[model samples]
Target: MAASRKVAVASVCLVLSLILLQFYVTSLHKELRAKILRAQITTFMSGLISLACWYLYRRLLAENHTVLACPSRLLWTLWKSVVICFLLCAQVTYATNLFFITTDPQWIAMVCYICLGTLIQLVCCLLVCDLIEIGLRVLRRGRQYQQNQISLKAQQTRTVVAILIALMLSARGLTVGLSPPPLKKVTIPMTKLPRSFDGLTVIQLSDIHLGPTVGRSRLQDVVDRAMATKPDVIVIAGDLVDSVVKKLGEAAEPLKQLQAPYGVYFITGNHEYYTGDVDAWFDKLRSLNVQVLHNEKAILQNHKQPEDTICLAGVDDNTADSFGYDGHGEHLDKALGSCDPDQPIILLAHKPSCAKRALQSKYNVNLVLSGHTHGGQLFPMIIAAYLVNPYYVGLYRVSDHAHVYVSPGTFYWGIPMRVFTSMEITHITLQATW
Candidate 1:
């Protein structure tokens, strides 16, 4: 019991120390930016919140003479509270600055967002393991007579397994967070594919998420990968920018290098509206020769021969109007305007959820491409994503005639971790079934 108490104390101290280090780094950033008042406020609030969370955690974990006072009883409450607090902090800060402030917090805000998400996910994982352990114990209750006595060999084996699991998880997180995304070539066989368009190569770059953590250098690598595909068509499904155009314009400048025979196309994701000035990004992309398909359609023909052509249509994100952008909302009918229905059609919508809607529409959309879900971005959360998103991560045939491919994303978003899912540059080759 004393050893367990000592371990708990050490764990708490370690967590507190890490939080303090984050605050110190944030303070230095603020100071460098000459925001003295903001720095002071942040430091004060950090200390206060840290103290309160630690106090609550200690109280909740305290052992007592009763069964109800056990650590497992309060673990859920503690986990939920911490997660809620972190989520609130992240959203409130980002939204407040996005709508109200002229000058963004930049790198400081980025660090906080990433750190908070990482901490929350790690704690959530631990909480889940604890719940599983509790369930196992409950199942074994009253079966003490049936329970096998633990031998030293078994105990040591268990310890080794636990250590190995810890090491593997740590290594995976670091690798996924730090490594550049690799190109994944996927082939799609279309029954109605045009004979002339057979062997059509399309490169998809989605969810680049250029911000403080992911910047020009990373984006350049993605661009290089896309270019290397030597694709006939290049499409940026959505989420090309994580921040406002003014802030990440230079970061996205490498996109000029992306070229394809059929030209490059882009559609706005929900993040575009969230960045506050969606129009600015549209203009910027257009200037870089990226055709913005906002309720618009473009026909791609075989070497400019209009008779052998396929229609490529794109719509604004479904959530555009929800972000207060009225005319910028997704309009499938308008995007599919005057398109040849017999010809195979491809639709680019930001969210994979749009696949069902596309299939429901009269438009003969042969394929829908998307990338917003990020394949859940981390473990266990993928389960949550599955619950919410009809099409969360990969390819699915929405109907006999229509299919949707949800890219895992070209980069990480808020949390600097990817487990089970990968950051990928998707290269899709289309073949005619006939």
Candidate 2:
């Protein structure tokens, strides 16, 4: 009865997912009926591809003489069908997102993102299985010259190992998604000699994504960690919140507790524009006493020697122009305006690409801190992120005078998971070089 119920559930989910997928695609391209028809055809092709994956799995098992009992085989097929249903739902949700970028993510939307992540994991496992099978076949053909078949036990062992690896990957995804980020300490050296600011610690919290996935408690955890470090200065590189100010205003309340001797600073990230009103978030952060650095600079003066100083500057996200928000986007010259060219400056920009810009600029920007990439967020995707980002993660020296450190994000983005990567809060200690 349980098996039958599982099959029925899979069938229902598959049908509903298909209906939603068609509706979303049709809605998006309603003006072009021919394009909609082509999308429907593509959807049919995707179904065939899923069916082919299952067929290959069955054939591989049978060829290796590792086929399970009738009931077990039936259960396996039902599970595969359920996975297909999940993939369909995920694709539909992504399609819907393109049309309707909600101010706040709904629970259903979160589920879809999770489903999408699981589907990708499943695809990776399938690829591994195929590669293993191909390797085993090559070994079998080689042994055929001696007229000896490969051991069935060996084949079974390979299958078990592959499945175990896949399960471990899935578990890792869950672990990263549910856990709080650990603190990572980093030290940077500056060329200009400033005895007073030496050993000054700066705690960086970037890509917090304070929203449905990351709630008040999560932000509080991050704040507590930052406070524990007793930083002289605190900086939020960007991506403070994912949702609109109205819906997630209270979620960021814990940020008020994030105090530092030099005060907390913030700059705009591309996500700020996505919330529809950049000003609302800016106002909200200001209310918390967090300094908003909108294309400007502030000098940290040394008390003993008032003339000795270090400049801290920040620019808007590079995407601000496409977003069309007022007073937004990277304006390096405006941000460094009035600053002494020889003064040691630390710059904050959401995307690491800004490091290259800082290197080209005449301003004496010693270091640039960023966190837009999230260090690829998950496996295989990291490989894709590398193609676009010159500095994907960790500290990278852009030039002799300029260096960039890209944080692996303090939290996950759309999906509440991290695989093969851990979330982090960075503590950068500055040491002066004479």
Each model's lDDT comes to 0.71, 0.75
Span of 10 residues, lowest total lDDT, candidate 2? 29-38
TM-score of every prediction relative to native: 0.72, 0.75
Q: Residue 48 deviation, candidate 1, in Å?
A: 17
Pick by lDDT: which candidate is best? 2
User: Residue 280 of model 2: what lDDT?
Assistant: 83
lDDT of 1: 0.71
- Candidate whose TM-score is highest: 2
Q: For residues 330-357, could you state the per-residue lDDT of candidate 1 as single tens digits?
A: 7888988677878888999988777678
Error of 2 at 228 (Å): 1.7
Q: Candidate 1 at residue 29, lDDT? A: 32
